[model samples]
Target: MGSTGERAWLSAGLALLSEQGAPSVTLERLCERMGMSKGAFYHHFGSMPRFRTRLLAHFEAEHTTAIIDAVEAPGGLPARERLTRLMAEAIKNTGPELEIAVRAWAKQDPEAAAVQTRVDATRVDYLRKLCEEAGHATPDMMAKLLYLVLIGGSHVMPPLSPADKHRVYDLLLPLLG
Candidate 1:
C-alpha cells in the first residue's frame, strides 16, 4: 500500500480507538472511514490483532521520539526545563481520549500492558539520564520519584491552570537543580 493509504488507516484506527474505544476499531468501521473495502484493509493488515500491534507500536515510537526530541531541543535549557516541556508535550499529544483508550485496553490486553511497560521504561530511563547529567545526588531515586510524579499526576489531573502549572515547574526545578 502507498504511504498515504497507510497513514489514512492509522489515522482512522486511532480515531476509532479514541472515539469509541478498541473494539470500535473493526474492519467494517475502518473500511467505512477510509472508504476502502475489506480487501484493502486485509491487504494492509492480516488481522485486527496485527493492526492493533501496529497501532501500539506507532504510539510507543511516536511518544519515545517526542521525548528524545524535547531533550535535544536547542536552547541550553536545564534538565528540569527540558523534562517539563517533554511532559507538557506528551500530555498535549495524548489527550484524555487516547489516555482513556490506553488505560481501558491495558486492563484486558497483555500486549497493551507490555507496550505501556515499554513506554514507562523509556520515560523512567530518560529521567534517570537527565538527573545524572544535572549531577543530582540520588539520581535513580530522583528519576523514579519524578517519573511517578509527572506520569501519575498527569494521569489523574487535567493539565493544571497556567499559574499552578508554572508554580509546579518552579517547585520542581529547584529539586532537580
Candidate 2:
C-alpha cells in the first residue's frame, strides 16, 4: 500500500482513539470508519500490533515533534516568544480527548507507555532549554512546572479551554523574563 493508504489507517485510528479511547481502535472499527477492509489494513500494517505501533509513532510525530519543529522553525525568536508559540501550537494542534486517551492506553500497553515516557521527556527537555534561554532562575523546575500545568489542564474535568490556557500562560510568561 502507499503512504496515503497507511496514513488513512493511522488517521482513522487516531480519530477512533480520540473519540472512544484505545478500546475502540480495533480492526473492525478502523475499517468501518475508513470504509476499507481488513485486507487493506493488513496490507498496510501487516498486523494489529504493528498498526498500534505505527499509530503511536504517528501520534508522537504529530503531537510532539511537529509542534516543537513549528516552534523552532523561525530563526532568532526570543525564548519567551518561542515558549509562547510552543504552548499555542500545542493547544491548537493536539486534542484533549486524544491526549487523555493515549495516556489511558499507556497505562495498559507497555509500548504506549514507552512512547509516552519518551514524549514527556522530550517535551520537558525542550521546555527546559527554552526556560534556560529565557534566564529563568531554575530552568529545570520551571520546565517541569509548565509541563505539569499543561498535562494537568488536559486531564482535568472538562479540560481547560484554549482561551483559559492562554490566560494561564499569560499569567505565567511574565515570570520567565
Candidate 3:
C-alpha cells in the first residue's frame, strides 16, 4: 500500500486528468493543487512519464477486471445474452464522462495510448471467447464487430433509461437467435 500522501497525490492527479485533460496535469500542477512539495510527488513516482504509466495501468486493471466479472457471473444464461448485458451494464456504470477523459488522456500520452490499445484488445478477446462458447463460426470477426458496436454505441446513443435499456437488449436478440 502506498502512503497516504502518495495516494492523495495520485488521486489529485487522476482528478486533474479527469476534469481538465492530460495537458493540464503536470507534476507542478498536481503539487500545487495538492499543496504538496515536489519531493512528495517524486517520492511516489520517479517522473511524469512513470506516473502516467502507473495511472494507465491502474485504469486498465480495474476496467478489465470489471468486464470479466460482469460477463462471467455465476449463471446459466446464454453466452450472447450474458455478453450484451455485461457490456450494457459496463457502459452504464462508466458513463461518457470517464470514457471521454480517458480518450483525452490517450491523445496526449503515448503510454496512455498503449494502455488503451491493450484494454481494447482485452475487450475484443473476451467477446471472442463468448462468441466461441456460443458456437459462432467466426468468433474473431463477431467479437471485433460486437466490441466496436458496444463501445461506439455507448458514446453515440443516449444513455438508455431502464426500459430503453431492455429494448436495447432486444436489438441483440438476433445474435442469440
Candidate 4:
C-alpha cells in the first residue's frame, strides 16, 4: 500500500464522516465501502489516531487553506471585497452535513475538538484582519459576530437556496463596511 491506499482510506473516511458522522468512519466500514483490505489502511495510517489526524489536516487544507489563498490572491478588489469573495467561496465549498458531523465529533474527541477550535480561530481571525484592513472601527467584535453568523446559520436552519444565500450576502455586505 502506498499513496493509493492512503487516498482510498481517507476518501472513504471523509465520505462516511460527511454522510453519517464519526461513528461511521470505522476502519471496517472504510475497508468495506472502499473495497480495500484492512492491511491497506494499516499500511497507510498505522493506527486510528494517525488516520484521524491526517483526515482533519486533509479537511482543513481542502476547505480552509485553499480559500485563504484565493482570498489573498492579488486582485484589484479591496480587502472587504476579497473577504466577501472568500465567504461566498466558503459557503460553496462546505456542506452543512459535513460541518455538523465534524462538530458532533468534536464533542467526543479531543483531537477533533482541537482541530475545530483551530479552524474557528483561523476563520475568525481572517475576518478580523480583513475588517481591519478595510478600516472597520470595531473589527474584533464585528469579526466575532460575522463568524458566529456564518457558523450558526446552518446549524439553525435547513440549507439556504442560492437566492437565499445571495440575500444573506447582500444583508451582510453593508455591515462589513
**Candidate 1 or 3, higher lDDT?**
1
Cα lDDT of all candidates, in order? 0.75, 0.92, 0.72, 0.81
lDDT of model 2 at residue 3? 98
Residues 1-177 of candidate 4: C-alpha lDDT, one tens digit per residue: 237667667767878999999998888898899787889788888898899999988777767787888878876778888878877887888777887888899999999999999998898889888888888889998888777666776687676654566577678668866
For residue 167, model 2's alpha carbon misses the true position, in angstroms, by 0.3
List model 1 lDDT by residue over 1-177, tens digit each: 237777689878888888999889888999999999999988888888998898887777666666577667877887766777765665556555775687688888999999988887887888788788777888888888766555555456574444454466557657865
Worst window of 10 by summed lDDT in candidate 3: 159-168
| Cα lDDT of model 3 by residue, 1-177, tens digit | 256776677668767876787777798899899998888788889898788777676666556766687667767888877776776676665545556678777777677888888888888888888888888878898788766555565566574444454465567535643
- TM-score for all models, in order of appearance: 0.81, 0.97, 0.74, 0.90
Question: How much is the lDDT of residue 115 in candidate 2?
Answer: 99
Off by over 4 Å in 4: 1-5, 75-77
The whole-model C-alpha lDDT of candidate 3 against the native structure comes to 0.72
State the lDDT at 64 in candidate 4.
Answer: 77
Candidate 3, superposed: residue stretches over 4 Å from native: 1-11, 32-36, 73-81, 157-166
